[model samples]
Target: MSSISLPLGGDVRKTRQNSLTLLINRFGVFFMILVLSGVGLIVSPGFFSSTNLLNILNAVSYLGIVAAGIAFVIFCGQYGDMSAPMTMAISGVISVEFMRYGLVPAFLAAMATGLVIGAVNGYIVGKFRANAIIWTLAMNFILEGLVRWSYKGTQIYPDMATEKTYQTGFFLPLLAKLDRHIMDIDLVSRAQAFNGLATTYPLGVPLVLYVMFAVMIIGYIVMSKTTFGNQLRVVGSSYEVGRMSGINATGTVMKAFMMSSLFASIAGIFMTSLNRVGAFYIGQGYDFQAVTAIILGGMSLSGGRGSMIGVFGGVFTLGLISNILTLVGIGTFTQKMITGFLFIVVVAVNARSLRKLGRDYA
Candidate 1:
């Protein structure tokens, strides 16, 4: 029998082609970002302004944090976390109420609240094998009811700036010190430069953005580099296969849920701090937004493959698009319409990619 062989040049060309394919598959989102950013800059002179760019980053910081955390659950092949927004709202409200006790206590309380909710989600999803969508939706409703009943439709605006200043003698300076410590030297310098350019921007942007980025890096490392992340991936890809491999699929899923909730809680605290207020319906639809960002990040709705970098890109993309639309005088309805349309486009692209890959593998 004779076997056909390619020439040396052919082999080199094939390798280059494969490399290009891999690059595109891995960095397609960045390409989209470059295109979008270019368009934004060309169309709106304000788009490239340092102040506007900083505003966009700051605006999207909370969403990025929330989406990063929720990516865990989505990565595990779960439907969605309905209770995330409510958890955020509840935690925010609790933090406001506890502010008088001092920032540390209030922050702890908010995080604890998130942990409790996450535990409940994990127990129900993991131990009881509950339907994630239905259970989380019910949990969200329960949280909503609790908030409504507790607040009686009232909005609590905690003067966090005043409280922090009074407690620390200078909120901005203290926060700046904290920022310098948390963020790397390079980022702190850039943030300081940006702040100098735009006096109206909040200091929280640097601190919160750095924290979110750090969390994403940690999450990525955990998911891609650790045994726990491997187990979760296995469970997401195929529960039966994971079980056959001696992995406790249930336990893994539960842990994912808990982690997701915990992050959601932390995001809630930051959001509340930014607004310095909490209302009964404060976090309405935030869960959907997080899910949208996750999906747009190129994560499989079917689960098992994603990246924190992609999620961050999605968050920034969504935030930038919204800001651009607002700047262009688009109404809320139009913005929602455009967002939904963009989401469909992204998901459709992802689905097509998955189908092609599956066919190739087969």
Candidate 2:
């Protein structure tokens, strides 16, 4: 009698699905990037020229920094930071306004602003268990209102003079050094070397682009190579499990929030320098957009998975889409709509892929 060989049909199907998903996960974004680049070249002449490519990188550079920080928060299973836009705007304002003291001082002050905000956010959310989404939204609104009120609904320019009569008397002299021409717009303009942060192109590469790359690389190292990164992944997987494992779950969460805020502040500072002005409205739409980028990069909103490289791809994809759309004469508002639609589609595809791998929605 001869024996017939048999195969487990279900196992074979699952093996095939697992391989498919793995392949998609590894190369899908780059493949899409290539496709989008092709579309750009077809639709927009010279879209991939060195100058224009640099332009795309520069345009998304600050936002990429913001997304890098937000990625940590998402990886830790917390919601996105809504206060990021304001963090960037306010920090930039601080940098520009404090430039009279010196570049180092102004930069430090801007950093301090971010540090304080991030600390407060971390403590409140991580310790008190405040809802991250609502709390961050509140912070965002509070910052927006405070900035608007303080500036009297006007933009703060490096060269713009402060009102001396009413409110300026108190703080201006307190912060300004003993110089008669401290209020002189020309002197202030000359002093604001901070603009170099955004303007300087090293080796013909935009400084902000370098900053983005640096931040992303650091984040990658932290997440992939550090013990803290491992702890963060454990915490993201399950806070209770993390606690059981003797991890500082609260501190880990706090650090994640702080990281996000700090990154946003950096982006904010550069953006302000680029515009040569600081306004509450600066960096608007960054929070949602950053979240979108994180999701697009293959990070689960439920946390415990993602890579900085993937996050950058997500950021680059968005920039590519925007460039291609612009080349095809798509209006800004319509581009937003199209991007929104794309976001939904990508999210759905990611979810489907995960399901095929026999994973839950987390």
Top candidate (TM-score): 2
Write candidate 2's Cα lDDT for 1-362 as tens digits.
22555554434445454566676675677778999988888897798789889888888998899999989988887767888999998888887767766778777888888888888888787778788888999999999888887767877666666555224321355555555565554635454577777888889898888889999999999999999999989988777898789998889988898889889988998899888888898899999888888888878776787888889999999899888878778899998898788878877887777776776474
Which residue window of length 10 is worst by lDDT in model 2? Answer: 163-172
Q: What's model 1's lDDT at 18?
A: 54
Count of clashing pairs, candidate 2:
1
Report, for every candidate in turn, its global Cα lDDT versus the true structure.
Answer: 0.72, 0.82
TM for every model, in the order presented, reads: 0.78, 0.89
RMSD (Cα, Å) of candidate 2? 3.9
Task: Give the runs in model 2 whose Cα sits over 4 Å from its true position.
Answer: 1-17, 162-173, 176-186, 189-192
* Model 1: lDDT of residue 352: 76
Could you give me the TM-score of model 2 versus the true structure?
A: 0.89
